[model samples]
Target: MQSPTKPLAYSYIRMSTDIQLKGDSLRRQQQSSKAYADQNGLELAEAFKLEDIGVSAFKGANVSSGALGQFLALIKAGEIARGSYLLVESLDRISRQQVLDSIPVFFDIIKSGINVVTLADKHLYRAGETNFADIMYSVMVLGRAYEESKTKSMRVGAAWENKRKNAGTRKLTKVCPAWLSLQENRTGFDLIPERAEVVRQIFQLADTGNGSFSIARRLNQTAIPTFTKSNGWHESYVTKILNSRAVLGEFQPHRYDDHGDRVPYGEPVADYFPKIIEDDQFHRVQASRRRRLVEGAGRKGPEYRNLFTKIAKCEYCGAPMRFVHKGRPPKGSQALKCTNAVRGLGCESISWRYSDFETSFLYFVKEIDLTATLKAAAERSERATVEQQITVIEEKIRQLTAKRERIFELLTEPGSSTAFIKGKLDECEAAIATEGAQITKLREQRSMADMLPTISADELRSLIASVQDMSAPDIFERRAAVANRLSILVTSLRIAADGRRPKMKGIRTFLESQELNPDERDRLIDHIEKTNKQSQRYNRSFNVMLADGVSRYVVVKSDDPTDIIAEVLVDRDGAISGSDRGMPIGWSDGWDNVFDEPVSV
Candidate 1:
């Protein structure tokens, strides 16, 4: 295969990221080598470009370090080496930087019949050119260039750092994950609601009634995607979420002025931004979390009906009685004794038997015919009145849209005086604003419509039918009913009005129970709203993704909106399907929402 007339070989060009040099200014050298190859009309062979390499000769052609070494390994196997022609961009690009000083070692490269052509010293070398003198001269020049470039790189880096410091740029913009947001400051970040919720969720999970590990396990089970989805989850992420005080939406390291105001840099902002959540709500959720502590610690005694145990008021001190069980003789006996009452307050004969307390409460578990009640509620007369308003809103939105389109026309017309046109523009803008406000008001009404009770009997019947088809487990079904329509009222002793067992005061409504009357509906709504507010005021029901793919939602959980970007999707016929995506703005309007996914008219 060795033809005597054939040209010797080719060369390869490479650039390793030299820490001192700017982006490859080795263009002139590459041009020289190309010129040399072209002038000779040397049948060009292969050219391999080695990039991002730190050292050319020291590190033997390794591509990426991990998981990607297989490709480089194949190249090193030398599957194809019959060619005698090779092209290199420059000599320095091919040779080792440190080996240039060792002239004899540098000359050894041409021994394999591979010529080295470098533009730095403009040396063209074949087997004979690899002598001691040529190697010594070429190495001396290339070494100087390398050291010089490194010096310039150090100077440039220092200048950039120094300029920023002098310009008073102290704060490095921080990418605070959810549970915190950052604002521009000379120093650094301010917490926003987006991140606060994450913080609260973390702490609440740690302090849950079910314990922290159980919370972590549950979170791990859900494939809750974290901020960095590609990296997966970790326990440290979970622990960080729980322990960080950033949940309160306050920078713990920051301080308020003497006037107790947050100087967002210089100006104090009095809750100008949407806060993460209140401290009271977060603390309450944490308090509810049963922590395993040593003996003599305040431990809540189990109650037959402990739902409202320490939370309800006491008769003696007028303060709430702490629920507790004394050991031995009263091991299984659950009692509510007033703490303030013992501290010398009021009536002592206020306690009732735990046996009698929950015995009368068994009616709470009574199952109502959901089909009948929901059917009646959904078909109520009020919904019929509300249905007629949709057409009115549609007509109004159409007119507003037409008016919005005319603003450009009025402003762009020729021969219009500035003052006259300005007035017209202002009038149009005012009208647009009015229309926008009206549209917003209507949209809010539409959203609030779902919050309204199902007064329509027929719709309730439909909902019941749908519910029957839903495969919610027994516990889920019971909780869902409670979430939608149940309320509890607890009081001691029933007041009899005229005769046998007074009809209104003593019992609680719960589980699958419904309002027996219009009055009860109002009462139920009040309690539902009250509980909702309480959940928000005191709970941290946000989630976090740990490094281990575990997801936890802890602290003060409300079933309302979970995140700011959350949406509430509604069909034209007024049934809410739920959120489609987390859109920062409103949902995109399309006819597909109406035609493709039509709701029950």
Candidate 2:
């Protein structure tokens, strides 16, 4: 039953991705819409033709921000006359959103005095129509579309699982690890010599008990190249390489959800990829890694037991500074040396004496007054109220900006009518203006708070005192427990090469507001910081004995903070001498020999 007088029709076309452009999908859709218009004797509205390519209907992108939004905008503006036909290839071509979400959009279209026509089924539903048949039919069609999408998704998952299972029996046809390439026959992988050697070196370092951070520093020091240009020889990359089973010739396949979180898809296939390192070497590296790495409340190793092991970094190359103890027992000498610099890895950082740095640090600590620091902290807390308000306003501005972008995307869509675009643009612009004004007000308030008085000398004194009291009672204890406590209170402590004194930053504000002598509470905070930034404990015990047949106890201080007790003797002339009475004057264990064996905490 054809209407004698045909109405003007607006054709809507959609495709999921631009890859479909390679096919005749666009041409076929256009041809169908045109044929239907001719057969029905409807006048096609050329200006109203809407096509949304590379968009997904299953995600409701259709109604939310694509051609559908623009079409609605046109209808609202009365750009398309009432009783005009809206043509699509099929119902699913319009939407694949779940029935509930899709039905409302269909209703709105019909409510706008437009008639929706599905060419394939030749079903026509008019504006202002409230018939049960039309509603139920639309629901059934949209539901089927939604269900079809879900079914496809499940099939994709199953297909990937099958491919992964096949991967276990056959080598990968394409795609290979950075260190490997396909062989001549394209059946197996062969090592990319230079890259393979790099992998070998990485395992070699890990085998010798060097952690990922140290390994990264070593690679950077040697000017070794990396596979990617974006992040060259990063600690995270080194860690990932060491953790991956691919080093041992295993392929682990995984699936990702919509949000990109990995899900286990299949069992790992050993020997699926060509091996880079020997199995024994790979397992040994893993063992070494396990022994050096510590996770929260998990296994820990003695290698990372020192309080200042990795914390005190060399300013020259940013490499970790380690304690270098000189001489055997009874002859004390030590310095904080950069391990990389000592190895002649091109770092020019200088070593520091443990005794000198510790003395200066203690001197600084003794001068702090806790009472004034607390008052300053309270003042800071008061300023935080304004800061909190500013943060809230800034977050609102960010959200509004995102909303504006989404609205602009809809307005710029191919199907957007000029009147609808004008209306939405005006609304979004007003909202943005209001948000900008609020942000400006908050910024001004924040600037005012920033002008508050600085931390007073008395407060600094209190901070230093608080840090000292929290230190371990055993001065001879391997852990520089006191220094670790101080590090927690500040963001960073940079020690200059010749200066030796640490310049601190970002003294935590809460320390000032705490009740005087807040005992366990302060300790708890220090404990938490310590766990997160676990430093290696060094051997701090050193001894010096006075001569004259009467042994006088003396503590020989050095810049090195390793736990080894270096015993030395002092003469009546106040000259420090070693206990090698029978040996030559220069006979002693040198500093170079200290690191011959691994230095575990």
| Alpha carbon lDDT of each predicted model | 0.40, 0.60
Clash totals in order: 49, 24
What tens digits encode model 2's per-residue C-alpha lDDT throughout 442-540? 666643212334456555444434433324232212122343344444333333443212211112345546665777666765664443223211222
TM-score, model 1 to reference:
0.28
Q: Give one digit per residue, the lDDT tens place, for model 1 in 538-573.
A: 221122222223222222112322122122323334
Off by over 4 Å in 2: 1-90, 97-126, 130-158, 183-187, 203-245, 248-271, 275-355, 358-601
Cα lDDT over the full model 2? 0.60
Best-fitting candidate, measured by TM-score?
2
What TM-score would you give candidate 2 relative to the actual structure? 0.38
RMSD of 1: 30.4
